[model samples]
Target: MSTPKKPTEAKAKPGEGVSRRGFIRDVGLGTGAVGVALSPTAALCAPPALAGPGPVPVTLTVNGKQHKLELEPRVTLLDALRNYLDYTGAKRVCDRGTCGACTVLLDGKAVYACNILAIEAQGKNIQTVEGLALSPEPDPLIRAFVNNDGLQCGFCTPGFVMAAKAFLAENPNPTLDQIKRAFGGNLCRCGSYNGIRRAILEAAKSAQGGGKNA
Candidate 1:
């Protein structure tokens, strides 16, 4: 068979050439393709950025105790608790306040530790899952959670429990709607919201008869 003819190089004119047109088109397509491929991946490969300035001295009251820590101002309350204070009860899953795994109670209200800065928690009574049983040996909510198997894999359990405790603290006798609203901020990836609901109801009932935060 005869050999295939190669592409003839196009000579350039003063203002135009076939090679220049092809080269321009190829360059544009190549750049466009590279941009399309790199955008999402480049975002992913970007570094874990700090919120702002370097670590600052901050005092946070945890579980009726005070802790003086020098941490990055950008650090979230969840990181402050889990990484700095060794309070691992608050899970760090979905640290953007979506998964409710990093929930805690601030001034008896459920707040996602991930959403708030550690510095913002100052002058507030911050309570975690660990603080639920502070005085009582076994908190009623904790007991209810354990009995109802409200947790699976136990990732969102802390946030659920903390939110429940805060809910019960506010509305010791909550309607189902109230309970649902109370836990609206917390989400469980394991689809254990039903169990969490049941556990909350049980805890509320228990708290009603002079039990715990019902």
Candidate 2:
């Protein structure tokens, strides 16, 4: 009926062509099949599970008393003393060996309890502030601290006392300059450095006058 009828191209019916949802579903199924095929091999090549060290027996001599405890080797001396032994004199502040708030005496030397491991402290002479007042009369250094008002807030007082005790033992008659230099490791948030220094000096004088150090 016309100059020559053009051949008509056929249109695809509904649901006849690849669809977005269908493509996605097919790809997901293929991936899942691959995963299922490889799962056995993957499991066979996997590494074995590892676990951390368990708690072991630890014995500590604190304040001239021996204590037996089961603790992890990684536990810190400060935690063992404060949490396990109930010796909370060493404040848990700046736990990274700074601030000196967790200072204690190990073998008659000042050390940060947070820095030492509980298991490593075995068989060592451990002295905390609580041990300083075992006698009826408080230690002279403690008396001096109270008299000079060397502490405020009192959080850092125990550390300061322990550090000062070690320092005085090393240099019984330390001058003001010596004290200032030695106490550089310890810090006071309340800014009680002046009173602390005076207390150290007074304690030294008292020791010279036949007063016991501890």
Summed backbone clashes in each candidate are 2, 0
TM-score of each: 0.70, 0.74
Candidate 1 local lDDT, 1-214, one digit each (tens): 1121221211111112236677777556645654754688755666765232334577889999888877656568887787677788988776677878788888878888889988889999999888767775789898888888898888788888887887778787877666767777877777887788888888888767743433
RMSD of 2: 24.1
| Model 2 lDDT, residue 19, Cα | 69
For model 2 the local lDDT of residue 20 reads 81
* Superposed model 1: Cα runs more than 4 Å off: 1-52, 210-214
lDDT of each model, Cα atoms only? 0.73, 0.79
**Worst 10-residue lDDT window, candidate 2:** 6-15
Q: What TM-score would candidate 1 get against the native?
A: 0.70
Candidate 2, residue 170: CA error in Å? 0.6
**Model 2 Cα lDDT, one tens digit per residue, 1-214:** 0111121111101112446886667556645654754688765765664111235677889889888876656568897787677788988888789899999999999999989988899999999999998999899999999999999888899999999999999998778787788988789999999999989988887888833432
- Clashing residue pairs in candidate 1 are 55-71, 204-214
Superposed Cα deviation of residue 143, candidate 2 (Å): 0.5
